[model samples]
Target chain A: MKSLLKKKCHRAGLIVVFAIAVFLGPAHGYAKAETAEAKSECITCHTDVKKLIRLGWKIEKTRPKPGKSAETAGKG
Target chain B: MEPYEKIYVKPSFLKTNHGKIGCEVCHNGDTKDPDWQTAHKGIIKDPTFPDADKTCGECHEDITSTAKNSLHYTLAPFGGVIKARANKKDKRVFEKVCQAKEKHCSACHSSCGQCHVSRPDYVAGGFLAGHLFQEKPCMDTTCASCHGGRVYAEFTGANDEYPADVHHDKEEMTCMDCHTGKEMHADATGVASRFDLPERPRCEKCHPDVVSKKPKTSSHAIHRNKVACQVCHAVANKNCFNCHAGTDKKGLPYFKSNETRMLFKIGLNPNKTKDRPYNYVVLRHPPADPRLFDFYIKDGLSDFNKLPTWKLDTPHNIQRITPQNKTCNNCHGNVSLFLQKNDVTDWEQKANAGVVVPQAKIPKPLKEISPKWKP
Candidate 1:
């Protein structure tokens, strides 16, 4: 019983750590995603997406292609 | 001299006189330093200074007199129609039409640098040094600012419709030609103290030729007769149509009689048609002779009944009755017929031949008409 209680307490500690990471870690990440979307809209005409990203715009993921790509095939 | 001897002698004298008094009593060290000669050169024994009025009014007492009589001081200082317009929300726009500065008497009456120092372009630097008599820009741009086109054209001779002999052009007169400090104030108040009337020489300054050739007795004669020069030669009305063509009450053009216009052009007003106090003589008519009476009819007995007729001489054009010379009784018949008609009075019969012919002795009047008569 003592071993089981100790195991349950360890699992609870992992869940709390996971919840804190999900809540705090993605706060800036979500802002970065929103910024990237806004930047993409600006870069369609500008063609200098890298300069905007260096100027504090966080670009995360681009639109995926329908055809096979190395990164998409790896994800699959 | 030895140093001890000089110091002892001066120190003894200073100790005897000044040791009893404070150091500054003799030296004035507290109030002013004796060694500061350059800074204390103009230091006064008494430190009191007169007020601004006493300092300025000493030299500018005459300015006070001039300002009292000046139009700018008398008329402008008190608020009037022009001042009311100047202090408005749209002051900049209103300044384009009326002068905003001239509304106050203090603007002109104050010391020179008060108004003129900033406007160096208008008044030269002498104004800042309190020289009020220096030339100013009043007649030029300053007057033109508010007076605008009217005064500008007058001074520049843009409106030269006046006759060639007009005084304005002859004298090269500016806006100050007729108006001065005194006369301008005369408009508001009934009385003014200053009068600077220009003499005849001022007019002769431009009209030298007219003045030299002027009759010696002209002025005296005019004065004796109480006649003004404007009576004969003056602009009756500025607009030609006003006098010649007539105008409505508002000075609008209207039709006028040609006869009336012609008479007015000759210095006669047709409306006032009373005869002038002058003389007119008529010559007498020439004598009527018998030769000119060819159209007369004769009525009498026998050949005497022929109408009396006359023939006219070509050159002299004299009219005479009867052929050349015939006796008196050749046409005369009974005397009663001459008395019956009584056409010719005694005076007429006497004056006929330059002789007093008696009425009863004259020939009888013609009775029956005859076709053989000359008439």
Candidate 2:
């Protein structure tokens, strides 16, 4: 029974390690430098996300402002 | 040679009379100078060199006003840079997605020289001429460069398919046809403009016939007591199922199954219901038989054998007639009125059975042809 418990514990530990390696390891090195450089360049040129949306463009993780927001700003 | 002859004698007189200026003062003259041609060429080339907003400004200052207000200029530098970066990122993603078979960045992104210079020859004159004149950048070689053969073909088809009244069909219009300058919210460098504004020539340009058919005959007319045209026609076609039909490759007839049509009728309703006070369906059919289909109420279902099937007489006009109210319960609050009206028993049995049903035929799809009725 003790041997079986040790075996199960070893399998659980292996599963945990495998999960971390599969998920975290690849994400860490996934074009980090290139992505950062490209994003920075985009921000440099476009200045803000709102402009991109107005041009019918979209980037991941950017929330579009309400349609009225732009009109209101124009009035100002 | 006399001193007067040296100063005033013409070239013809040089051989006959005393030589002029000793041939060296003005000409720096070796009578047959070897390097003189090279010196003169350099001066001509220097003046002709192209410089945006400056070289072209010499001839066309007014041209700059249109461009400054144009989306291309408004979103320059910053918008362009962001687009370039995004293009690079997209290229990487495309390379991965297409397994490197397809290239993406160059397809959509115009190169630095492509927009700034002209083709067939990349001389200073070419660059200057392009900037001075209001010509579309080279779409054939530059735009088609990385866009692949399929996209090039589609663009050609789209150009051919565009209606004559469409702004793009007008002389010298371009990809910026619908995407007007005022619509451009982003600065050239990719920053949002200080003001975000709705573009003009909105919806009404293409659908002028529908919007302005009659003074009181519009979808807005039905709910004018409640809503406005901007409330519904604000977005492209306002989610009308028919207008957006065959838009998606998957939903298109090429991939659609018979079962799929039975399960969920695609393109039947171009105008989908939205967050308005009352839900309405906009039915559109060719105006050839204008009197046949009624504009108001749900009288069209009587013409069709099934809910959406109509027989077509001519292949050219495959008219799609959608009724105003689709969901019977939406407005009526019950199905009893719908069943009573649409019932075959309500009419004389033989007349009901022999009702001439309209059919759909497509001689050609939404392709531009010689106008049936001259404008």
TM-score of the first chain alone, every candidate: 0.37, 0.42
Q: Kindly list the per-residue Cα lDDT of model 2 for residues B260-330, writing each as its tens digit.
A: 01010111121123322322222211111111112211222232222222111111111112121232222
lDDT of 1 by residue, A1-76 (tens): 9999999999999999999998988896988955653332221222333443433222223422232222211000
lDDT of 1 by residue, B127-165 (tens): 222112223445443454443333344345444442322
Native-referenced Cα lDDT, model 1: 0.29
State how far residue B288 of model 2 sits from its true place (Å).
Answer: 44
Cα lDDT, model 1, residue B86: 35
Chain A TM-score of candidate 1 vs. true chain A: 0.37
**What's the CA error at residue B350 for candidate 2, in Å?**
58
Q: Which CAPRI level is candidate 2?
A: incorrect
Worst 10 residues of 2 chain B by lDDT: B236-245
Give the runs in model 2 whose Cα sits over 4 Å from its true position.
A1-76, B1-51, B65-70, B73-201, B205-375
